[model samples]
Target: MSDLNITHEFGYKNNPNSQAFIESFHSSVQREFVEYISFNDIDDVYNYYMSYIYFYNHLRPHGSLKYLTPDFVFYLFNDNFNDFISSYDFSDFFVSVKK
Candidate 1:
């Protein structure tokens, strides 16, 4: 689907193009984390997963986000996508990152 079309379909009122992106984020984290972590139960997994999120948001530099971490990229992408529109298409915003 076209970016604008898909954006409308999955978007919320404030950010009409946010749902798909959020879903894609969950999926990527799930694939990279959910399947990889061998936690005995939910608590252990939650603890480790929370740490991983900290790394992703505060440390990991994402190429798609202009080599910025999720913390940086979050504001960048949401503020205005015109800067990185070429590298990140709408679909990519919904696809799992390569493991």
Candidate 2:
């Protein structure tokens, strides 16, 4: 849904974990974005958020997947991780230390 006011606007039905996760995510996002930014206007905040979102999606490593980024695993490995599974091809391409 487009509405970010998830908890207040649309209450979590049976999943309380989702609410916690969203709260945690909001805290993290604030720490990473809102806390540092000096908001002059909503447009400026939106622009900054767009850039941050790009970084989160494309650059940040996911902890669940052995700390490898989604793009790094899919696109960086040419979408075929098995191709480099034989050798240290894709594994050694980036940081050897998982994340």
Identify the candidate with maximal lDDT: 1
Assess every candidate by TM-score: 0.50, 0.51
Flag regions of model 2 displaced more than 4 Å.
Answer: 1-16, 19-24, 73-99
Q: What's model 1's lDDT at 68? A: 59
How do the residues 13-90 of candidate 2 rate in per-residue lDDT, one tens digit apiece? 896576775676677688988888888899999999998887665566667657776556675557565554564334
Best by TM-score: 2
- Model 1, C-alpha of 85: deviation from truth (Å): 26
TM-score of 2: 0.51
Q: Which runs of model 1 end up more than 4 angstroms from their true locations?
A: 1-18, 73-99
* lDDT at residue 88 of model 2 (Cα atoms): 36
Q: How accurate locally is residue 27 in candidate 1, as Cα lDDT from 0 to 100?
A: 76
Residue 92's lDDT within candidate 2 is: 29
